[model samples]
Target: MEYTEELLNEFYNPANVGVIKAASAVGKIVDDENGEIMKIYISVEKNKIVDAKFQTYGCVPSIACSSMATKMMIGLTLEEAAASITASAIVKELGGKLSDTKTRSAEMAEKAVKAAVKNYSKK
Candidate 1:
């Protein structure tokens, strides 16, 4: 699978690759097929995401997607991020798309964001 330079850059030097100890929202997901895991942490203020971070154990695409998703979510309202942060968007931001086998990576990132929003709503 060929990856764009932008995608490779994200994979090599992923941003927001950590945890927020006092995150306002947190979400996690696991890929049963491969045991890959992704966790997202978000801090919200005035209904907007003030910050975001992630920890992922998976392929390059997964790590890149998670990093891109978190960067995209920051500064967005909870509702906006939940509704707008789709797999396609993450792929696009990463410079087009991922291989068929790695498509789930972007999906996982999307799901994680939605899960974080859901967690915040419950609080």
Candidate 2:
């Protein structure tokens, strides 16, 4: 299978693969059927995402999507983060054209982020 440089880079050097010292919310994935597992931590200040990170174990697409989403949401307000984040957005940021199956990773990343943000908003 052929992969682009963007895919390779994201898969090999994913950003935000650590945990935040203090997070308002943490989204934990406990499903393996999809083979895309991710745990995200979000730090919120004044309803904005001051910081975000995740620990994930999945294929290249999943990793890239998660990494990209984390980066995108870093300084965005919760509303912006929720509105701007999506599987298609991740794919577009990666230059588009991901396999249909691989696209789930992007969706998973979006859900994870939203879940984390929701948890934080509750607190």
RMSD after CA superposition, every candidate: 0.7, 1.5
Model 1 Cα lDDT, one tens digit per residue, 1-123: 799888999999999989999899899998998999999999999999999999999999999999999999999999999999999999999889688988899999999999999999999
Off by over 4 Å in 1: none
Candidate 1 has its poorest 10 consecutive residues by lDDT at: 94-103
lDDT (Cα atoms) of all candidates against the true structure: 0.94, 0.82
**lDDT tens string, model 2, 4-110?**
57767888888888998777889776557966688889888888888899888887777888888899999999888888898888778877778775778888888
Scored by Cα lDDT, where does model 1 land? Answer: 0.94
What's the residue-level lDDT of 51 in candidate 2?
88
Give residue 79's lDDT in candidate 2 (0 to 100): 84
What is the Å distance of residue 41 in model 2 from its true position?
A: 0.8
